[model samples]
Target: MKTKITNLQPGMIVGEDIYNLKNSLNLKKGQKLDRDMIDLILKSDITEIEIMDSNASIGFIQKTFEELPNIIDETIYNKWIDSISDLFHHFTKEEIYVSLNNITEEIYKSLNVKEYFVLNFINSFGNDSLTYHSLNTAIIVSIIAKKIEIPYIMYKQTVKFSLIHDIGYAMLDDRVINDFDSDDKNALIHNIVAYKKLQDLKATLNHEILESILYHHERYDGKGKFHLKGEKIPPLVRITQVADAYTSLTELGYTPYQALSWILKKCGFIFDPYYVGLLYEITGYYPTGTKVKLSDGSIGIVLRRNEIEFFPEVLVNNEPVKTGPDSNVYIKEVIE
Candidate 1:
């Protein structure tokens, strides 16, 4: 029962617990795969398959987790980064691409727009980094917007800007971005550096999108390194700036619930309370892939949840468990 998400190609047998997508839907599991299901998942935004094959049992993830605390070790960080970048490159190459077109809409039909949005972020991020800091940042923005119940399309645009937010990185060497710089000119480096590189991608970036990325680091206190702070800040720039900061935290290991708690406590100091609340609503108490312990002493991974509610579609004991007609299990604790 190997339950690690790694390289997944077609023709792979899958009967064990696994995540799948149907028209931009989030990952679901335990469903046997025929050719059509296989093709549909392949075409969706599924970046990783936690289950190896159908013959394997679902409880493998927990057994593996208890034995090996880190199924994904240090080497996994780079692998995840690469996987993310490649996913964006693959989809954005041709069309705007929609991960789940409408099935999720049916699942959460009664949920508020914000909850729907948080689901969207979890579903979207299920793919690899694709654009690293940028795409992840976009996801954070989407999450925040969902929390606040902003229109899905508006936040979706925010995500678009985020995905290509640093598309310019495509043109530069690791030295320019993945390194630290002196405070003086370094303040201006992040965006200017990225903006300059985007020029080479042949992308059709507009002023707003470019400016958002260009000024993502600026603040409203007028003390930002780039110094384009205060009212001089554009709305999108301010939005992306905080979204980027918050997303960085999640990427570093904070759960969406933990992050939302911190944001609520620190809002108005390091971040705007209005937007902070918005982001809090976007991530929900849990997002997909978050591992939790059930009251019965078994553990599961959260796969889906609305921003407003606290429960999610989780895989208990590594076996896929849905919160639908068959089960009545509730979460006990998250595997921090």
Candidate 2:
């Protein structure tokens, strides 16, 4: 049955999950809600209500998930993942030649004014495609920077650097570029080439920031691109490396949980320990879209974020779970 807020009552059944007026829907969760108390809502007009069909809607969603396009397909999208990734790709490759003067003038102005951008890429769309890859890298870097609450200027420039960082890949043939090992020494050559090209354009960038894009591949264990670590590696560079890997993996097929877990598990080995800790906290352990089981044995679709990494806003039996991090009630297990 379709869930309609207006038609709902405290004790009535909506979906597989039970309806508890006190604990569910705009209040602390995990217990039954009091109908007498819920009468207070009667005073206010119900402007917007969230609801879902318990059966057909959920199964349809699950079944149709894999059939969805692997890459950004829609000209318009409101979903979080689709919008962010698309923004990253679209901005970086908007022009074949992102000159330093143009990058400085155009990107700086755009970043200064707008908090976000969009990507509508189609001509190039694979690992072999250099422009798409660069855009992907920039967007992931920007996302990490934003999550860390980087200052607007720094965040904007980080994105600009990321966009120009992989310009050298255009020199390689499609086949070779496509098949090139992401970890291969040849990756450094791309940075080197891009760096020189940027210099020719008279790139107006801080030295450290420029190196971030050029040497982001450098590993902590001396096995990576520049083989440099400690203070020698710029902070943004390290951030980009981790974000780059996460984005590429996530874009390929791994879910957000999978990508973040990989980063968390590789702490200090491939990623900076400090940043790894921060990223782990920011991204959390379980994937965002994962379905979970509550301590009370109720199942809910993971609704976006709750204050706690593990705690997420949930929709139980077609009604929203309103508990928060400090609340005694929370998700307890993966429900499959």
Clashes of each: 17, 4
Q: What overall lDDT goes with each candidate model?
A: 0.47, 0.48
Whole-model lDDT for model 1 versus the true structure?
0.47
TM-score of each: 0.49, 0.55
Candidate 1: tens digits of C-alpha lDDT, residues 20-113: 3234222233322223334445676655554544345331111112321231233433444454455445533333233322211321232344
Give the per-residue lDDT digits (tens) of candidate 2, residues 1-336.
444445555422223322233332232111111243234334344422333332323111111123222223333211322333343344334332334234333333333212222121222222323444555565446545666777867776677676655545554322122211243344547667656645543434557655775776676666665668765777776666665665544433344555566676766777777766655554455544456788778886554454565666666776667445455667787643
Model 2 C-alpha lDDT versus the unseen true structure: 0.48
What's the distance in Å from true for residue 327, model 2?
7.5
Q: What RMSD, rounded to one decimal, does every model reach? A: 14.3, 17.4
Residue 139's lDDT within candidate 1 is 47
Pairs that clash in candidate 2 = 20-33, 21-33, 22-33, 90-119
Candidate that scores best on lDDT: 2
